[model samples]
Target: MQIATMYFKDRAQLKLQDELLQYNLNKSKGKFVGKRAEAIRELDDFEATRDAAKSIRQRVLDNLDTWLEIFEENARARGTTVLWAETPDEVNRHVLDIAARHGLKKAIKSKSMVSEESALDHAIEAAGMKVVETDLGEYILQINDYEPPSHIIAPALHKSKEEVSALFAKVHGTAPKTGIQELCAEARAVLREHYLTGDLGITGANFLIAETGSVFLVTNEGNATLCTTLPKVHVAITGIEKVVPTLEEASTLLRLLTRSATGQSITNYVDILTGIKGAGEFHGAEHMYVILVDSGRSKVLASEVKEALRCIRCGACMNHCPVYQNIGGHSYGWVYPGPIGSVITPMFIGQEVAADLPNASTLCGSCASVCPVRIPLPELLRKHRETQVRLDLRPVGERLGLRLWTWLASRPALYAWATRLGVRVMKWLGGYEGRIHSLPLASGWTNGRDLPAPAGKTFRELYAARRRAGRQT
Candidate 1:
């Protein structure tokens, strides 16, 4: 897929509107509302579980270096080869090297966000290899010429069923008038063939257990299992932050992840261990490689923003965020979206490229409330904005105007003069109706509305008159 970076604040509101409408439509069609409500209500201590998950993740972040070393030891013991890449180019090169060594031509992949971050689809395609996405959401994105995924779980969430039908017809050599069910059936048949014939598979791990070198994959459609097991060579790409200290810790986070994401007590399938198959093995990859990509995660961890590392990608924040619900994920114009994206995108991509994302929020705290790991999402976004302003990445007009306002605010006489001048100008703009349908300085505030004119009397004048009236009394 062609991945594009965007300044979130610049495009946030419009994106949010799209996401909100999309979520509402999805809810109407998918029973998401009732399902989530029932699942939330059924848990005796959902809040407690959320807290437990947060605490465990906090400890992991605090001891990340120690846990990573331990995880490496354990994974190697299980006969899995672990490779670390410090950059996207390095990760891509490493994966390509593996495929080249195996002489792989066809590969299957499960849903992995880290792969999305690395632009793996385009990378592999550029290498003259055919890679197929096995997860339904990912498959939709893959067939659509690798448009960036709109939602973490449901990549085609922004697309209506009609649109999907059209895409399927165009891609699968089906008739344009094909029915939705028929299109879906055709896709399933086609993907099953890839599963059988693919020479390599790639997947993303939900959790990496340091004690056993085991990566846990959670999925509903069992596509991950096929992507990992059916191919002769399997390659898994994941962010470094995915590691936990032990299998027990991984299980705890996994428990919270499923319920928080889709309201499932457990995903339909969770693959707990991975490595090369041995002699007489009925299923599993013959060659397994786990690529740990740092990207910008290490830099983020080194900073005070390490709390963001606690994220398990449950996507609860995006699901509940008002802005994300409205705009959907495309507006963020990055791999991760919603509140989490707002904080992490700037860190990874650079503040200048992502200044708009931080300002996109109303700081309503909805994301923080629903975050499975208790990440202070809103506060962190605000912090990003403050940093952006200090870095002079904020709009030039706003910055200059604020500097002038600060000067006026410090001098009462100048402030009073400016206030009177402002009233005179506003009175002129008010015209006969005592309102400005539109104003130059505040056009964005009144694009589809009107700005009320200031009252005739100034507060200073009114205060003096009131004092005189009291004396007379």
Candidate 2:
């Protein structure tokens, strides 16, 4: 399938008119915001947690190679095989090779954004193995036949309860008009069988502990535990940056992450699995495997947008962002979406592929305010704009306008005269309404909302007038 990240403008335009999308977007974010607000009020040390997470991430990045090496050695010692994947294709090849070697006919998976980024599900299906998504939202998307995830956390937030009921009946052979719990039960009944019988299981790590070679998995539905335990061959695909120094650091991050992402003080199911199940253990995969995927993350680590790596994939920024609240995640056109995606997508996917992303923001700073790790998202977005200008990727009209503005601003006399003349022209154009319904060469801004005409005088002129009046008094 063609990735949509390159066509953000087109996707956003279509998304704006989608009544279903708007309803879900508003409902989903509103619910999360309420929960998060309450959670934040209860946590007195939330700021400290953010600081700790930020510091921990900074340390990890500074010694990233050391930490990854340590993690590899410890994991190997625990009887777990670690695969290093430098790119998406390499990740697919490694996963396919594993499946081929095992002769796995079917696989079940939990929600894993890294896997999405690698498109591993499609690759495995192309290799002739069925992969079932165990998470409720993901299961909905999967059974719907190849629909992409629209959000970082909630895959099917775009779906309504009624729509889900209809889909469940159509796909799962369930009774019609199922309630939410009934639908969940139906999915669980089917997924339980997949868990018991699947040849392989794949999952993503919330945090990879370098100390004991543990993969931390968090989920609300408790399916990740099944994904890890029920299948005899378990595979974890995660970015190299997921590695943390210790379980303690992981815990601190988890506290902030859950609260910020879903407004929960703690997620219901937080599992920390290390190594294969020992001889005395009742269950767990005999052969444990983890694929540490670089997948252009190394380039991000090497770039000015390295602060984006501090993200724990909490999804808070997306939930709080006004742009995302209206247009929804699919409009961002990538695996990751919203503020975080806008900052790093260009760097990961390239400036050319996601050129419209930086311009998609209002620079409101809401995302940064809600982010648990405190990545300066607006500043990073500004950097992306600078990158676009440096690369000369902007349209000729926008470039020329910016150049003209710069020229006028550099000349104080010209700027003052021009502002006065422009104000008069706008007032005349607005007539009695004092609002601009249309403007030459700037219809995009004026098309929807009325643009108030400029005040009679500039700020500089007003300030100067106040100064003269005060001196005379």
Candidate 3:
């Protein structure tokens, strides 16, 4: 919600020292990675599906305006109002105006990252209306003073069951329960009332079908179904990039989304909602509205990072990221986290504020390998880094260091001499243990762990000796 990217280094240091957060993150890392591997192993056409999903997203980005107009026409034809907002502020204003026009009071929400991007809950509460979160994870966050989500797919993944038990006990004024089922029951009992009585329901669409003018809602808890069906008015807020050309395309993307996100063949519930309640329909919203928020996405579409628009928010990149695994998502200090966050946060916010995000990665390529849509996350991050350097956004020391490296790198003989001298110096510093425990200028690396010393000889020396031996032989 707030741009705390400037405090990333500080927040990351704090998260690193938090043992409870580390334990929770470690527990989740294996579950998500293992499940996704098993799910991929079971699917014979997983690669093909990934390619199709990438193609589908690229097609939409290439012709976003045309597809958006088609979606609006089709959606409006089905008695749904499609509203466009250029910014997050505009998105909030539109939602507030809708609430005023409909005379709606109590609003129930399912998990919507776009809503988080817009800070919709705060806006609704400030407007003097009650907004309740129905998704269990979101409801937990709402009760906990609305702490931001740690992970996109599993918002409260940072919280252990014991922690949640205590939280529920404190917030609900009930006896503490340790068992998962009991805790869920308590939450359901509390949320069921809000679901039934709320006049306005808000959700985020996983995918939008342009052909059918339908919003595709995918969830494990089925709360989205209730949010859409039980309320007098339904509002779905999502990015403009979510629209697909047809259900067939959406179906292909869905296959990849579920597997990549949670390693499930499918979620517990999938709803293709079209417009309002029909004449014979027993339960549905009287008013259906879809708000497509651009909110810097168009700028991203025009920039070098346009490939990021293909993100299905499956969070495979984040789940597999080593940086995210250790520090958790809150360290990124933005709505999105992990590898994708590193790319897009700077694009959405300015590089001046979020420049450190791009440099957060180790460039290990794990994120790119596991990404369902095959987004070159590492390359995108490098692009951000290049932009930062071009704009002189990096600190003075970093820029000077890069310039020194560049100067040496341009001269082959000097670079070779420098490498040899550097290796020997490092070897001496390593002493008997062959580990550099401390370094003068590189405290960032040594503070966390010791760096292995280089060997006595450089790679060029080793290669030259090998060539000479072969010639003698």
Q: Which stretches of candidate 1 lie over 4 Å from their true place?
A: 1-3, 7-34, 176-181, 278-281, 410-428, 431-434, 457-472
Q: How do all models score by TM-score?
A: 0.90, 0.96, 0.95
Q: What do the candidate models score in CA lDDT, each in turn?
A: 0.81, 0.89, 0.93
Q: Point out the higher-scoring one by lDDT: 1 or 2.
A: 2
User: Of models 1 and 3, which has the larger TM-score?
Assistant: 3
Q: Which pairs in model 3 have colliding backbones?
A: none
Which 10-residue span in candidate 3 carries the lowest summed lDDT? 41-50
Estimate, for each residue in 1-473, the C-alpha lDDT of model 3 and write its tens digit: 88899899999999999999999999999999999999988778888878888999999999999999899999999899999999999989989999999999999999999999889999999999999998898899999999999899999999999999999999999999989999999999999988989999999999999998999999999999999999999999999999999999888888889999999999999999998998998978999999999998999999898999999999999999999999999999999999998898998878899978999888999999999999999999999999988997888998889899999999999999999999999999999999999997999789889999988799998999999999999
Clashing residue pair totals per candidate (backbone < 3 A) = 18, 0, 0
Report the C-alpha lDDT of model 1 over 126-219, residue by residue, as the tens digit.
9999989988878888888787886777677777667778888788877764476776777789899999988888898888887788888999
List residue ranges in candidate 2 displaced over 4 A: 455-473
TM-score result, candidate 2:
0.96
Clashes of 1: 18
Candidate maximizing TM-score: 2
